[model samples]
Target: MFFVDTVEVPGLGNRSYLAGGRTAAVVIDPPRDIDRVIAAAAQRGVRISHVVETHVHNDYVSGGHELARITGAAYVVPAAAPVSYERLAVTDGDVLPVDAGIALRAVATPGHTPHHTAYVLEEGGEAVAVFTGGSLLIGTVGRPDLVEPRLTAALARAQHASAHRLAAELPDRTAVLPTHGFGSLCAAGAVPTDASGEPTTIGEQAAVNEALVKDVDTFVADLLAGLDDIPAYYAHMGPLNSGGATPVDLTPPAVADADEIAARLAAGEWVVDLRSRVAFAAGHVAGSYNIEAGEGPGGQLALLLAWLIPWGKPVTLLAESPEQLAKAQRELVRVGIDRPAAAATGTPEEWVRDGERPATLARAVFADLVELPASAILLDVRRATERASAGYVEGSRHIPLHELRSRIREIPLGVPVWVHCAGGLRASLAASLLASAGHEVVAIDDSFDNAPFVNTPAADRC
Candidate 1:
């Protein structure tokens, strides 16, 4: 009588679920955009009877409060979670009746947060699925360092215990549906999967999840060691989620013209180009940063822009068309980049100021940089882990993209910079930033695999 439907917010790499029997359903870990959850409930032919949260989210705002209000569903939150709203406070072993022979049983599973809970969906007293929100994930566990630095170590230990506890108590076949695993920053490390590469289970986790397979000490050490930079925007998500984040305002911002666009840039506000990296690299308005807009495997606009730009910086968007602008706006709001201050949609030529030419940037593959020039600076902008995982060239300067804005001055004014990331996406971002800063840049529009090719003379594998 019950079914589970995943509502994936691919941009942020999180999932909300709408699952229940024939006539009623419950939503877990919904995104800031509640309409998708509402639509899922309607499509399931069930009314939302309960809206549940496993924890106060740190990645995106929760739609649970508003969804419950809209549907008159019972709002369920973990007991003692620091939420400002009223909710059905459920603790370990608490059961919420769903339908005939169907129910959700809450199990206290901290580590992701002090009050994090995982819900076990049961049919006829048998575990059907476990919604492991930011806890035990596919091949890893929720990162424990999102909380205060002082609590990270303790939380890492607790994360290990929580995974073991879930594995020990639940039936091995119980489906493990985690909110953070499919590219979510909340996940600590890479996710390993079987040939199928699908959602995991308790049985599968025991072999692949470090938290379940390794001893607590080893898992904690490895997890802590693998921790990377957290998204800067996460600082606001927890407070907004707990304090009842309002519905996202994705209504299009007032459009801007070339004059306004130039003025915003001159005033030190961000005017991001939401075009393809190649399109951006070919030509764009002077000082406008390039964060290409798309939501596939290569789409890094939302994450990269929110990470690089100073929080609450006034933003103006430049896109090739209205459709591209709309999509980019939605992506921004998913990460709490609510309303853009102003926006413009047109070709790069349309955005150029009077007496100014559309600026052009150069792009090259790794092979093009074989013989280092005395006049050029080689910059590597990928995270430390990526550089470590994939080895670096001999003389490349290392400054990760996230830290590049504040550290821009370290690179001299007149020298030309040749920048590259693991792939071309981040290098394009770095290239644009360097251009805006008055330094000539060439984006290494090739994969890092080709870097080793340039070791001796020229031309290696891409």
Candidate 2:
């Protein structure tokens, strides 16, 4: 009777679990790190009965679908899930029989994202534990603003209602095993951890979680007050979870010759140099994007580089060999930038001699101080959720990146357009988009939680 809690940390995205008796196991809220889950099941010598998701996650790409493909297990999600979930969608009071004397029950616990649920495991007539995904964290509940538009009022009402429902329903003794723990962003307040910083209990959470204040109204109000900045990539995450678009895991077929690579570069293919910073600086293609494969699973900085590079342009991957390319692809897919083209033939020296063109673009941080004073217009290319989470830079026009294409005419092209996202990815993408439309533009990396904001060249920032 061993229950395994699979902790996929750091570069992996989110945590998950493999729980059950000897005959079968159930997985919850899987991230892209499917290998770990597979290995755990192998070690335990149990077939995974089903992959369960507590809610549609926005923090990282959900690996439940991919895991289901690998394990041949049932992919069970909530029926209230916004999109087509390709598997058995369970509703409240629904009991999924796993094996002899074991069953999983889905209890509707919305607020995180409308259809959120907490799965309770009943083994041999005793409720074992509840798999609280993002709904209830170590010391906090799920944020309602992830789906609900209004941050303050709307999210408050939703989260408050959801928490009260969970608190009132679940039995006190049910062991609570949640998807995210101490370090997860799902918890708004400081995560409650054990002495050595591990996931605490639900009983502990009920006692001290600030969001669960005295009454429903105050709890919701407090939730609305401290919402964090919703990542720019979140808007695309939910749809992908519900089977909107399949990720193209583009790994180059095989390593090619330097001359052939050089030819491709000369033909105007963008280079994505997946190498170490030292190696890149020593010698690399003139116009290649530097993203090292050694940075570990999902190099966040590397992913940020991918986001900043001009979208819609042909990308040529530059890695030492096919093995490196495979690793780079893993990193790229972790962040949703799938199927990057293989690197073209040739070393940096060869490409230089061939007179391949350098990728050119003007970059700036697009702060209102500079643009407003100079009579240039400042455009906010961040999402509504982002604006609600992290307040927009004062006086900046709000035109989210997704709507930028259609809303371009609203901005005067004659004046220099300054653009920015919550951090910098969307800003870079926005700047490139504006540049393609013939607007003189600059993208800036603002909202850095550290260091006094400084101005420098794009090369330095990149």
Evaluate residue 352 in candidate 2 and report its C-alpha lDDT on the 0 to 100 scale: 50
lDDT of each: 0.87, 0.64
Q: What ranges in model 1 sit over 4 Å off? A: 192-197, 453-462
How many clashes does each candidate structure show, in the order listed? 0, 10
TM-score of every candidate relative to the true structure: 0.95, 0.67
Model 2 lDDT tens row, 1-462: 546565554443346788877788888887565777888888888889999988887756777888888789998988878767578889988998776788888888776777888888888866767888877776677667777585446655666666666666666666667775444455554454332344455566677665555587677766676666555566666777878335344546545455656666577666566655444445655445454564333244433544444444556677665677766666566556666655543445544545554334445443434434467777777656555544555556888776676778888877887776656555655665566567776666565332123333344456
Clash pairs, model 2 backbone: 250-339, 258-345, 258-346, 260-345, 261-344, 261-345, 262-345, 364-443, 364-444, 365-444
Runs in model 2 deviating more than 4 A are 7-9, 32-36, 148-152, 168-176, 180-197, 213-219, 244-270, 278-283, 292-298, 301-314, 320-324, 344-462
Judging by lDDT against the true structure, name the best candidate. 1
What range of 10 consecutive residues in model 1 has the weakest lDDT sum? 453-462
lDDT of 1 by residue, 1-462 (tens): 789998877767778899899888889998878888888878778988899999999988788888888899999999889988899999999999887888999999999888999999999999989999999998889999998999999999999999999999999899999988777889999863222345678998888888988999999999999998898988988898888877777787898989999899989999999888899878899898988898765677888887778889999999988888988888888777889999988888888867878888898998988655788999999888777666778788999999898999999998889999988988988898889888988899898877863333233236
Worst ten in a row by lDDT for model 2: 448-457
